[model samples]
Target: MFQSIPWLESNSELWLQISIVGLGLGAIVLFAETLHRLTGNSSELARKVVHIGTGNVILVAWWLQIPAWVGISASIIASLIALLSYYIPILPGINSVGRKSLGTFFYAISIGVLVAWFWPLQQFHYAAVGILVMAWGDGLAGLIGQKFGQHPYEVWGMKKSWEGSLTMALVSYAVSCLILLSVQGNVWQTWLVPVAIAIVATALESVSKLGIDNLTVPLGSAALGYYLSQLLPLGS
Candidate 1:
């Protein structure tokens, strides 16, 4: 039940683009961790860098006009390798984080699944917003919360804070709105859906444990954004 690879030969340019993007993204992750180790820097910061970098690289698929399948395949393969690295320690960046969770693999799989199923139907923007919110929003929340979390709270046994959750919501809304507007338009009417999506995504992230938020935040945002887009017209 297999077919010939379309991006292999006839589309050498596509293959090259995929290879460059994949290698560049991988290098970023590896280099970030290596730099941290070499400098005796904090390991947590390195993981955050990798998280944001991986999410941002998804945009390259759109930028380079790479086929969705190739992008999806790359995500799946990389995620699988990351899952293995948990045991093998092949990629220091993948396992350098002290947290005991498969969130990294989950993050990769979530993005890959979205690209394979949702992207080609013209709703790729939703996936982008979701991943971006997880990347920048969630990533920043952790950083800011750790640095200046004065008001603390717990959600479903997870220790977080008003500072972090609020950051997640605000940043998620901003990033979602910016990406959506860039792709759809700058219509004022389109604001509500992104706002709703951001809230839902943030809420989902707040309660997630064992790194489950990696799967929930992006998928939840995409699903919410997609449904809301149907109900609420985003056109001017």
Candidate 2:
């Protein structure tokens, strides 16, 4: 089965790179959130937009194989500066519209660009699947959960809903499988990988007791998909 997809043999580095990138992004989000709370400021939409947009641009530049430490250092510096600006309260005059939705969109874009850069040239199809799952699946889960979540489930002492989590998992897995099969030409195999990724993503999103879902879901799902693809003999 692996023989059918020769690309995987040469593209192992891509997966590793993506995993590293995802983890890095997650860490940055965690740090930013902590900083925001410490400063007594909500992690508003403007802040998120700057973080996501700048982060994506930096990751894309790195993906172009420009340099290693250059992009990483620049991202770190920029993030630190953004965090500091929150304390200083630089922008008091400008108000933006759809800050939350816009931030989420750019956040999703950052993840997508990272996947695009690190994954094997053709494995982009799989990455795209992961991206869409993170954006749409998580987005719908939040929207529905906020509006209609009545029954709450306490998992690890966190207030989450089985209803919302289940919704996120099902939608994410379905979308992921559809995209993967359609794009990777692997329509016959059991959907174990997609299911596993959905579960991981949902769990992470639900238990984001630390308010880091914006960062974790995308990277976690993508990494899960990448690893599962290896075990499933998918023709990446």
Candidate 3:
């Protein structure tokens, strides 16, 4: 298993960094969720604050290491734009878009660009794939689950559903695999890496007792992708 995965051998440090970031994000999300639950607020505000703070940290870290001004600027600007859009309301009928939704979309895109620009180039494809998967998969799952979920499974005293969870897992896996394979130039091995990532990400999504899927899913998916890439001929 170890011998088959060359990306891991070459980029272990990158994976470690990704994992650490993921853990930090997860911790913050959990804290925010707890506070929101206790105070009867949406906790969306808390999440935005964390998002901006984390984006700054990521920008500094990447800038010091990479000297990539484009990415650093994008991260800061995108985050600010996202936050501002929440309050300023950019377009006509923009309020229909919803602040949280807009904020999350911009935040996810910024993270995706940052990861793509700063992380090891060889593993950049995986990180990008993971980001896309987290954004679309989680968003769709939440929307569909809320609107259509009739039967619910009680998880951690919350009413969730097998249908929603399954949808999240499947969509995340499919999208991640498609993106990774396209970038890595290895369409055949898609089954090996993406499936593993999907499963891990899905499991994390299912039991995210901390409401940190934003932080957990992308990073977790990246780790799983990295590990799988080691076992399969994944990236450059």
Candidate 4:
């Protein structure tokens, strides 16, 4: 039966659903970038918006009850669009955030890939927490580091600050705690898992180069969180 074929049936609704979310996200980026230019806020803030926006936008997939492939396809299409902006000078504000790298592409790929991998496992929370940490922990690290970094060190010669790294760890821990608590409820054992995930996530973020930390932080954290969730009594 063709029912097994994911695309044999009309996917127009799926396409439309993704398109609407796509447009919404694009508008958000453009608007945030304009504000960034007007206020002279560091590009990192706009970058955070994009990072957090991309991660959270998956909620639309959940909302519309779309299939996993629909969500993955949407991410790929959006990534391709953002990738084109690099050459065309559109989305310049988002482009201005990072050095020469395809972090944007990886960000898109990370979302979809992690979703596909974790969806079947019912461990999507790990993916969500991972992306959230990368968004908040890494995003805030850059912003705070740029503003208040005093004691600097070199990780893989990339020149980071103790302040930023510490921020990454703490914020990651806090975000992890909130996510786990909401999904798994307040249990004594729940606190221990995020601590481990935060540590591993921080280390991975520290070593990744060429802006690949955008991908590494989330996937690494997700993998660690997934394993820990399995081992720990995550829920009562």
Task: Highest TM-score: give the candidate number.
Answer: 1
Ranking by TM-score: 1, 4, 3, 2
Superposed on all Cα atoms, the candidates' RMSDs to the truth, in angstroms, are: 4.3, 12.4, 14.5, 4.8
Scanning candidate 2 in windows of ten residues, the lowest lDDT window is 92-101
Candidate 3, residues 157-189, lDDT tens digits: the string is 556777778888888878876776566665667
Poorly placed runs, candidate 3 (over 4 Å): 1-68, 77-122, 185-188, 208-211, 234-236
Each model's lDDT comes to 0.81, 0.57, 0.59, 0.77
User: What TM-scores do the predictions have?
Assistant: 0.90, 0.54, 0.55, 0.84
How would you encode candidate 4's per-residue C-alpha lDDT over 1-236 as one tens digit per residue?
Answer: 43465673467686788688778787778877887889887766777777766666655655565567766776788689768876876666677433576777778888888778876776667767878888788888887887899988888878888898899999999988888787888887568888988898888777757778888988988888887766775443
| Cα-based lDDT at residue 105, candidate 3 | 43
Q: Write down the lDDT that model 3 would get.
A: 0.59
User: Which is the better candidate, 1 or 4, if ranked by lDDT?
Assistant: 1
- In angstroms, how far off is 207's CA in candidate 4? 2.1
Q: Residues 163-235, candidate 1, lDDT per residue (tens digit)?
A: 9888999999998888877887877645777788778987888877878899999989888888777777755
Give the higher-TM-score candidate: 3 or 4: 4
Model 1: worst 10 consecutive residues (lDDT sum): 90-99
Task: Give residue 206's lDDT in candidate 4 (0 to 100).
Answer: 79
Number of clashing pairs, model 3? Answer: 2
